[model samples]
Target: MPELLEVEYFRRLAERCAGRTILHIDVPDAHALADGRSPRSLRQAVVGRRIELARRHGKLLVLETDGPALGLRFGMTGGLVVDGELAIDRLLYSPGTFGTAWVRFGIRFDEGELLFHDPRRFGRVSLDPDESRMGPDAMAVTAAELGRALATRGPAPGPALKARLLDQSAIAGIGNLLGDEILWRASLAPSRPARSLAPAELRRLHRHLVATLADLLERGGSHTGDLMAERHLGGRCPKDGSPLERSTVGGRTTWWCPRHQH
Candidate 1:
């Protein structure tokens, strides 16, 4: 799946389309349209408008045009291909090869083209997607913002720490892999209660969260995290010589070093 790092790459690739006028749009799969949008409605939105900029919020990519903004959500296996250049060479769990039949949507510019390729058809395209629902971008989130997001309001323990991290409404751009990596690096347990953290722990969590995202973005993608290799059945922790533990946290597979992450 394309996480924050991968989506950032897609945003960079989309920058190629900036200042280019849309000559045509190819909606080979109407199911790719999101928010109950139809092909005709999509065409009516931005057929001949000029792409002014490419922006990203969490996993959503938005192409600001002279007219309406175009939004893209690359579900699990979707990718961006601009002028035959792929934003990412390959995605984990995605097919190794590219097929023409997988192109769900496309845009023909005056000079080149951009293709939204997704074999599973889980990707979506929308016009003027609502960005207000999402929290702050994970890459730029402040410690205060994170504190507010994780602050417990009642006597309830609240959601698990990992669940809070994975919540796009609380902190945008964090997916399964990044959540585990950040928790592991911060030496925090995934199943810890959201409200259990002290001020110091919150600072540590914020530090690792920002650092992990930056490190992964520089390395390549979310799959390149340090804890990625030890996410399996018999995998051992790279930090200590202890056996890694695996379980379901926040409805997603989670791995952590029981010896170090407390």
Candidate 2:
């Protein structure tokens, strides 16, 4: 499934579509975007009411209707791209809408409840009123906030690092890719105990965490840096000349240079 960056990249597709007065709902309770409610909500709240712009929080992308006030989560296997801009009439709601959807991506939601396309079916979509309700996007969160979250880690650092990062409450949007990015930037072995980091090292790691992500977004690329090597039978990292190594961490394949990353 696509990670956060991919999810965000695709989410932009929703912006290109011409919402011809309305759209259908396919995703679940949280799936405003998945359900067509995101654009609907935006049209009603944003376009109708005339709001300025919107933003994304962690995995949740919110449209600033400000009038209707809504947040959307694309879930896995869900995102948009404006390939066709056609919307048919009341004949009946069908994939035709997607042709007009200004984007051409759909799972053809079947769950009477809502469709969640997680190959592992491990991904989910959610919503909240505002940042106060949904909570802040991790990228916007301050170092102090991150430190407080890390401060409560387990006596051991490795598990602690993984747990805190994986937990959405401590920090939103730090998915598997982000965790590896953090570990890689810190040059600290992912298995290293979270509590074992020296104060200076922790500070540097935290700074790198934010800076690395910023640079990736600035460059508009994957935080993976080289996320694919985790699966490459034999591959070379794009950065260093060292041979890539692959192993499992938290049951997820991880690739890195022992020399480049501690």
Per-residue CA lDDT of model 1 for 1-262, tens digit only, reads 8898999999999998999999889999999999878888898889999999999999999999999999999998999899999898877867667788999999999989999999888999999988898999999999999999998576787899999999999998999999999999999999999889999999999999999999999998999998888788899999886899999998999999999998
Give the per-residue lDDT digits (tens) of candidate 2, residues 47-104: 3332224456677655443345445454443434333322111111122233222222
Total clashes for model 2: 12
What stretches of model 2 exceed 4 Å from their correct place? 7-52, 82-136, 153-158, 227-231, 235-245
Per-prediction TM-score = 0.98, 0.62
In the predicted model 1, the residue pairs found to clash are none
Worst 10 residues of 1 by lDDT: 90-99
Best by TM-score: 1
Model 2 RMSD, rounded to 1 decimal: 8.5
- What TM-score does candidate 1 get on C-alpha atoms? 0.98
